[model samples]
Target: SQFTLYADTSSRRPGFSKAAKPDLAVPLYEKFMARCRERGFQVEHGEFGADMQVDSRNDGPVTILFDTEGNL
Candidate 1:
């Protein structure tokens, strides 16, 4: 069985700041489901979105973790 994952750092909605924009939900959902099919796993999908508005902003790199079978 094989699986594929897709991620995007940009959003579908426009006019919002990159840091505050909602992500491309449709593409993300499609890719996730497709990967489940390729892996022969029963499709279980979850998504979370946020627009964090923090005072006194600090610049830093963003990191995401996709846990597959308990492996980082």
Candidate 2:
């Protein structure tokens, strides 16, 4: 999965100012990926700010979208 943290509000051009800073986000991303690794899934990822390209295939036609207001 490609986790691109984004801002809450919409705009023609996105500015991820509301996204978690790397100090916070990186550790969480690492922990999540580690859990996936523990589940026996081979995983590979790029550095925090690297440009990445993903080529993937979906076996099932399921789509879900979520939005958050930053209120727990």
| Model 1: number of backbone collisions | 0
Show how many residue pairs clash in every candidate, following the order shown: 0, 0
Per-residue C-alpha lDDT of model 2 across residues 1-72, encoded as one tens digit per residue:
365757553434556787888899889989989999999999898787677787867778885344344333
Could you estimate the TM-score for every candidate?
A: 0.29, 0.61
lDDT agreement with native, every candidate: 0.48, 0.72
Error of 1 at 43 (Å): 1.7
Highest TM-score scorer:
2
RMSD of each: 13.6, 5.0
lDDT of 1 by residue, 1-72 (tens): 121233432444222233322357556666767988899988754434433444554467874544444443
